[model samples]
Target: MAKKWDLFEGYLKCDPNIKAAEVVTDYVENYRSQAISEEVQPIIDRLEKAKADYFNSLFDLYEKEAEYMRIDRKVKDIAGVNYYIKPVVDFSDINLINEPEIVGAQVLTTRLFPTAVKREKYSYEEGAKA
Candidate 1:
């Protein structure tokens, strides 16, 4: 009868977090148990630093992935800018104003950046009815 290597190997593979975590606990215990010179213990310290560097690299990758989703380049010249800034929600921003009631509502109030929208849409101090 042939032995199934894949089935046996499946039990051995562990999650990186579980594996790294377990290795860390074991490393600490092993280091503590060994008879050693005071100077030799720094090797264990190096392992901790290397483990930290590995996780830091993983974090840096995730941040880059998030940043890549944004509109990357800003138009330098004002005249060169265009409608809704081409999908960028800039208040000085252009956005999908998603009030379902206002979805089809015309932007009767679009004023490009630097070009002021002409209206007295608000009173600096409107008093309530007494």
Candidate 2:
């Protein structure tokens, strides 16, 4: 890390356009500015990049959503005749005691993908609902 700072300092000093000596006079001043800049600049750059990426990703998602909805509608139309999407809850992995009562009461449902076996039996010969 120090070596990186040294290399950057050397580069700045060698640059004819910059007044590197004014900014980096003493060891403490040089070390502090470099450390501060090193820590801060990357974070700022990362946040900027992330913001831009987020908007781009959002645009991508928006473009795909209409197609996805169309496909989903087709699937629901086909599979939804005999079966409706059922919500299942599993508390096996959860630390129920540590969590709030309201949290346990909240229901999470899978409306998109079916992950259930219907209790009612469907038979072609019988043509029954049971």
Candidate 3:
């Protein structure tokens, strides 16, 4: 019989940073547990610092994942059919005409982020008035 591995193994195998992220997460959880269980003030403070370090590491990992996703989107758009990505939410009533632009406004408005189609939904009273 052959050994069977789950799909998650493929994801974990793709990036070394993911392993580091997992290690940091374990440390964070351990420090959190220690902070909760122990009553010593100094030890709790030290654990908090350790937890912060783990959080910072996880943030860096997340940034790398974001960069990877950006590049992956580009590649997929170039090679595959143009389509909307997942995790989209529809906000049809919000107006952004007077809103000030922030950094990466173009990317956010595009397929990478959730789109807000500025339009009103159909209502009985509004329809009757129209």
Candidate 4:
């Protein structure tokens, strides 16, 4: 990871155009600003990149949610029914007596997708009264 920072530093130093060098230098500076250790710049930059990527992914997901809701239930049911509506479900009767280690949780997270099960609307008058 240090190699990446070294490379970026070298690029900033060697570039003839001050503007280009400044951009790289600024990015390097911003990316590494949080780290007090000079040697940790690469790690910081990698983390910053990861943070940006993660945020963008979350943002893109929010933008995609509109289309996800518009899709009909029949299709979702076949894909595993109503899975999307409550996709990534979890319920547990178990309890931890103490703070758990990393290995404690055995829960699984499902991909966000709609459920396919057709929920029949209950009508008292139409059924029993009729």
Candidate with top lDDT is 2
* lDDT tens digits, residue span 31-80, model 2: 66765675556556755986799669656755666547666667668888
The better-scoring model by lDDT among 1 and 2 is: 2
Q: Which candidate is the best by TM-score?
A: 2
Please write out the lDDT profile of model 4 over residues 1-130, one tens digit for every residue: 2224544565668855445656566667764563445445544665598679966965675565544554544456777843654322111322322323212442223432223333343333353212
Please identify model 4 stretches exceeding 4 Å from their true place: 1-38, 72-130
Clashes of each: 2, 0, 0, 12
Go through the candidates in order and give each one's C-alpha lDDT.
Answer: 0.42, 0.52, 0.49, 0.48
What are the TM-scores, per candidate, against the unseen true structure? 0.26, 0.35, 0.27, 0.30
Where does the lowest 10-residue lDDT sum fall in candidate 3? 87-96
Superior by lDDT: candidate 1 or candidate 3 = 3
Model 2: runs farther than 4 Å from truth? 1-36, 84-130
Winner by TM-score between candidate 3 and candidate 2: 2
Give the local distance difference test score of model 2.
0.52
Q: Where is the poorest 10-residue window by lDDT in model 2?
A: 106-115
Summing lDDT over every window of 10 consecutive residues in candidate 1, give the lowest-scoring window.
Answer: 121-130
* Predicted candidate 3, C-alpha RMSD: 26.0
The positional error of residue 78 in candidate 2, measured at the CA in angstroms, is: 2.4
